[model samples]
Target chain A: MISTASAVIGSRVSVGHRMLALTWLISPLLLLATWALVAASGHYSAQLLIPPADVWHTFKDLLHSGELLEGAAFSLRRLASGFVLGASGGLLFGAALALSKTVEVYCAPMFHVLRQVPSIALIPMFILVFGVEETFKVLLVTKAVFFPVALATSEGIKAIPRSHFEVARLYRLPRYSLLLDVVFPAAAPPILTGLRVGLTRAWMVLVAAELLAADSGLGQMIEMGRQMMRIDVVMVGVITIGLIGFVLDSSLRLLERRLFRWKAIKE
Target chain B: MNASLDQRWLASTSHSPGALQIRELSKHYLLDGQPMEVLKGIDLRVKPGEFVSIVGASGCGKSSLLRLIAGLESDYSGDMQLDGKAITTTSLERGIVFQDHRLFPWKTVAQNIAIALKRSPLTRQEKALRVAEHIRLVNLQGFENAYPHQLSGGMAQRAAIARALITQPKLLLLDEPFGALDALTRISMQRELQRIWVQHRSTMIMVTHDVEEALYLGDRVIVMDARPGRIKYEIDVDLPHPRERHAPRLQELKEILLTELAGSDADK
Candidate 1:
């Protein structure tokens, strides 16, 4: 009975420890409460700053009518398809550049210049080439996702210690086996970080594309609400986009943890 | 089959006058169109099963010679024959342990050892058993799942030893594997290496700047002078494996190495 009590106390201590570790989570809640207070005070006009209660009501109405759900699903699908293709292509291309001196020498300068041009800056060119269609949105996401992943992969591969390469040679690890077993694992953590950054950037770009031209998606829904002067609906759309982005970043972080358990074991 | 291979390894080292025969080995480094000769017509031989330690001042090409034998550097002129086979690129038949543990941070202890076995034709069960056996040989049981970071410097090095031995190589080359360790740990690891070497009986060649370390573990100590390194002198330690640190023969060799290194420094 005494041991059980001690176990209960131990669990409580661990819970307290977790709460302390996650102290940053309180800031967003505080910001939300402050926004509600500012809206209630009517310091800004209602059109510019809708009360949280009204936003909540509009959010519920949109949820009931399934408009928000449909819009979110559409945006998510476009994000996934474009980001996957872009990130995978970037990974392979980056590995090639890092592994081969000739490839790096020939391609590096052009890639460097191209990466500086922001994805949003290319929207007009994309529109001119592909027109204002599904292709344009996907291409925008692809552009956003590609550079970070490529840069991360190249840098990560280069950062691997020379000693490790010597070890690989000493083992006479076959070409494919060396890549699969040593090179990829050594490169994964940074590549995963790049993927997370690329994904979030692509998500933001997709929303911008939808805002500019798309017929459906949360960003377009917000544009429609703005045109109709339904500020509450626009507010709901903004909140949902932010929340979804947060969830995506968190989940990618979880996967990184799983893949890099060996790092933690060493620590 | 295993017994026969071990027997052959023993016989080859015993019957042959030299375990390693290097004749007219030369290496030149080119910098900005200037050719600098690092090793100039070096001729050396290590007798079978002899624990030879090579010592030299920094930039004396001691490490470069070891690298040539380890098959890390192929751009050299000469013949380096081990047990009558010309040394080329790395082979499973030869093993090396470096100063750093060099264990992959992503792999567990068992996984790291298993990587060395991947190219071998051994069955999966046999590989697992051999890996476990080597781990025990290095006294690292119950650490099968531990990552490299989880181990202390000494333990990680021991794991590295196990990985090298897993291939059952004919020759073991150590390039200052304990240099990065603390003084206390270095002594203990030296003792551990002595014990392990006694048990395995492989032809071991270790390189170190520490004269005492070279004297304590080596059967024959070869001292090299500084500029464009070459063998200056050799002292034979007739003491057996797991030899006492305070043994009269070891003490004599230790004093000789100290005076040689000190005399070389004074000459410079």
Candidate 2:
């Protein structure tokens, strides 16, 4: 009984230790501490650098007013639609480039050159062609997502060993079975990584697009706050953007782990 | 009279199914803008349920020969036939296990085996049963749910064997199936493979560098010379299944093979 009690205590202590070791949760707390200390030191004017408490109050006010939530929801919808379009196109195009030598020969060189142009750089041209509307912002996010995903997908397909194809041939697997069972799974780790990278890039580009021209979104909120001299509100928007990007990336990483659990065992 | 009848029955049965006949088999590849011959003027005939081992040094095109037989490489001047049908492309009737187990790392042992049954007309339940049966044949009953990465090298190769055999191919080709294993594991796996072959009695052709392995498992060991690879000689083991490893005949054949290999290296 005494040993069992000690074992329970030991288990509780380890659980607490694990919580402490979660640096992602702890990092923001550390940043908050530093901000509070700097605010108390009075090194700068309050107008120049708002305290964490003031930022918190601004965040609560935005929440209660529902503008922040509405902006976030609208931003997420655009991101989802753009990401889906861009990623699907990327997947098909990438698989084509990998599978067909003729397609690769014609398009690969041009693709390499075109993908070098940043989405932000193309924003002006997109605005001219698409107008400064939802199309422009959505296209910007799509452009951001397409290049990375395509490159990753193509590389992943290329990296598959010839032996895999031989095995498929030996088994005489149907074309659909080859694609679903062999090609997809063999190339998935890199493709999933590509999706994660594309997601974060999409989020970043969407924010940048909103900042430049959007009538709504967290980025627009930040811009409006800046114009109104509400630094605390801008800070809240910035923090929210970072948090959302972090959440998106972490969830993708979680999914990757779950799907490619075999990789972890091999390592 | 009964023994004679049994002998005739066995001969007819062995000659009837899975007979691979290769004639004037030659393969060429372009190297540095020059055509290089890999396999030259080869002729081999493998009877049904016979285990033929081909041994050669590296670069001897032993692997290429296996690939040609497996129909992975078709650019060859050869008349290759299986059970009187021309072998032009990969077929479910021919199964191959590479030097590496080549078990799809993403799949569990059972899934890897089941994937080979995709083209089979067997029902789902029958396929599952066959997969389980083959898994048991390879002594991997408890590892059905385990992924390839989770298995040891020997176990993974066994799983590959199971996968290859699950289709119940008329002929099975193994390209150095135990080449990647440790010495002890290789010995044990060779024994397991012999046992499996005894049980299945399907035509199997294995390519390996190990002379003892070739002699121990093969009904006939074909020794090939490098540089325009061709059969230099063939040694008939004339031994039965579960043969003693230290048999004088095997030891003598191993010495002859080693000398032949070393002599060719000297000639080079």
Candidate 3:
């Protein structure tokens, strides 16, 4: 009986591991297969319905020519710089609003109203102000990253129980120690989630800004491919954009797990 | 060995250090824009190394009184003094344990206890040693690295107790510290707490709703009445430490206290 139980448990563990590994590949494989079958049916126009092989060939061509890498690097640099500026500002502003009643009362209404104005909606005004240049694209990305981060940070801070602060007071912990030991850890999970959402939003806005008006970038590359009627090139650009976004999101999730390992153990 | 080290350290410092004196202490709160009295004319004296247990029904202001004593609440009327000093704000000399344990969920047991020592003048090594000792004092040595969520309710409350006592507070205030535990765990914890009290001899005040608990561990059990809460009567157990749970005296006192508590309910 013991042997059978051990055998069952061992097999179950291996099955669980297999399922986890399969999850990462399942969706992409299914999508690829569906695309290939649709292209092979010849029911649609070939110009619009490029096969998986053609898209793969185009991806390789772009990689060998270094256009994809250059566009990706430029887009990433803009994303990094803009995300850093917007997220830092959002964190500080959100914490200030949470901590100071006066700041919250005075600025919260305005912040809420302004955050409702979507980043894409402000593109025309931003283009007019900063011109069709790096500034316009970076600013658009920053605006995209800012609101979600700020809202998340403020909400996270507010959600911390008053008991935590009371405990801090009981110990008479210094300001820095209270913040470091109590406030930050208590507020971190939500803030990290906000950062993740901000990062993805920033990437989407940056791509849209580039597609609308830019001399270079992955979005511009796709736009150029569309103008030139090279559907395969556009497909490659789309796939690359998706892959990069996935990588960025996954890296942030890894960081969240590392920092909040305690949360995982609880579950 | 570590226990003796802790005992020696505690002995070297002033023993039986805290003496709490309350003079007609009353507190009011704004309830829907109208002032509501919670505690009314509460006067009590606790000598150094005394264990006082307060029992009352819910909304009896027993918790508010404990909060006031811990200096977590400062808007109350009347005077409260600890060691001849006025109680205004929280001091390291007074530590509190709430019923819910209130351990920082993200921190391990060791980290939670060590964080309480942040404001202490002790060196880092001494703080670490003291944390280990207190963890041992609570009989939670192997669970040092466990998070609060990983602990059972009784274990988490034990960790909370260690955190409260880590600063060597002269006065330790517990507000329903064992109210959330199961009957079996609660009994065990009461015994554990009694053992610790006998060993350390700190001035401790615990507010509980359990008459048996108050009678079991307290040197003096004070019964309170609610609705503008005030002390109704006090019972001196006149018993020594490590008293038997099934003692005839305790059974007799429990019956008396239960009757008094029932009378208060009837009056309410």
Candidate 4:
């Protein structure tokens, strides 16, 4: 009876320990404390360094005025459109590059070189051509998203083992089944990783594009805050941007598990 | 006399349609742009509901022979037929299992088995039922939801066998299916395979390096020489299904095969 009872408690202890792991939050708390301490030290001017409470007030003000919502909606709309457009194109282009020798031979070198030219570097040229309109920002995000996803999808398809294709052939699986069941799943992990990278990278690039020239967005709000010397508003925008990136990354990480679950085995 | 008559009755059944006939089959590989003989003048015949095991050295192209019969490659020159139809590109009539259990890691055991029925005419309900039946056929009933990575080597191989047999192919080819297993697992799997053969009575061709295994399970064991693989000889096991493991006939055949194999290697 004692042993059984102890085993029950032992199992519960693991759950209890998981709850206790909230101590991990202390790291972020330490960073906040450091920020507050530096502000209190009065080394920097008031315009440059506003305390955490003032930033919280500015957050509340922005929230109540509906500017935060409007800015977030604008940025997310850009993110969604750019991500969908680029990711689908990347999927098709990557599969083509993997499937056709001629396409690969002709396009692969140029693709590598072009992707190396950062989307941020293209921002000025894009503005000069496309103007400060939404086209410039959205296109910048699309370019940022396209490269990683395409590279990952092509490399993932190439890495599938030859034996698998042979098995598909032996069974005479239909082309649809061969792609959906075998090809897609076989190449999923890397492709999904590429998508997540593309998503986060697009977010960063879009924000930078907005800050450089856009009339509205979290980036524009931050630029306005900087222009008006509202350090507290600038802090709020920075915090919100970091928070959005974290949420996007964490959500995709959740979807990572939804895609496939293969436990690693040594053998 | 009765056993021979029973075998004749089994062979003459029209319901079993896995009869294979091969003649003058030869395969060549371009190693460094020079055509090297992989298989030379190979001839073979298999009756319906028969289990034929081929044992050979590494370079004997036993695996290549299985692949050709599977219709995965057409580079070989041969007159190969299955159930009176010329072997063309891959067809649903043939199935194959490799040394490695090639279960897709992302798919569960049931999904892996069901995918074999992609071209099947069964409805979704029927496919599910067949998947369940095959799971039980391999004694993996509770592990239907388990992924490939969650299974042991032996269990995974059993699942592979289930997947291969689910389509009810005319012929099933196993290329060193149990070679990667441990000694104890290999023995158990051999027993399991024998049981499956006895129950289903499907035509099967297994390629292995183990002489004991070939003699134990096969109705006939064909030995081949390497470096331009050619069938040296074949031995008729002449035993009924589920024979005793320690049968003297099996031991005798093992000795003869061992001697012939070693002598063949020495001639090289």
Please report, in order, the local distance difference test score of every candidate based on alpha carbons.
0.86, 0.88, 0.91, 0.89
Question: Can you give the TM-score per candidate against the true fold?
Answer: 0.90, 0.91, 0.94, 0.92
Q: Per-residue lDDT tens digits of candidate 2, residues A1-267?
A: 999999999999999999888956787789899999999899999987999988889899999999999889889989998999889988888888888999999999999999999888988899899998899988888888888889888999999999899889989899999888988899999999999989999999899888888899888998999999999989999999998999999999999989997763633
Model 3 Cα lDDT, one tens digit per residue, A1-267? 999999999999999999998998999899999999999999988999999999999999999999999999999999998999889888888888887899999999999999999898999999999999889888888888888888888999899999999999999999898878988788899989999999999999899988999989999999999999999999999999999999999999999989987774632
After superposition, the stretches of candidate 4 with alpha carbons farther than 4 Å from their true spots are: A1-20, A265-267, B1-15
RMSD of each: 3.9, 4.7, 2.4, 4.7
Considering lDDT, where higher is better, how would the candidates rank from best to worst?
3, 4, 2, 1
- Per-prediction tally of clashes: 0, 0, 0, 0
Report per-candidate DockQ: 0.70, 0.69, 0.73, 0.70
Measured by TM-score, the strongest candidate is: 3
Whose DockQ is higher: candidate 1's or candidate 3's? 3
Under the 3 Å rule for N, CA and C atoms, how many clashes does model 3 have? 0
- Candidate 1, residues B92-198: lDDT per residue as tens digits? 77788989899999999999988988788889887887787778777899999999988999999999988887877778889898999999999999999888777
Screening candidate 3 with a backbone cut-off below 3 angstroms (N, C-alpha, C), the clashing residue pairs are: none
CAPRI grade of model 2: medium
What are the per-residue Cα lDDT tens digits for candidate 4 across A1-267? 999999999989988898789877988999999989999999987678888888889899999999998998899999889998889888888887887899999999999899899889999999999999999888888888889899999999999999888878877888888888888789988999999999999999999988889889999999999999887888898899999999998998898877766746455
Which pairs of residues have clashing backbones in candidate 2? none
Candidate order by DockQ, decreasing, is 3, 4, 1, 2
Chain B alone: TM-score in each candidate?
A: 0.90, 0.92, 0.96, 0.94
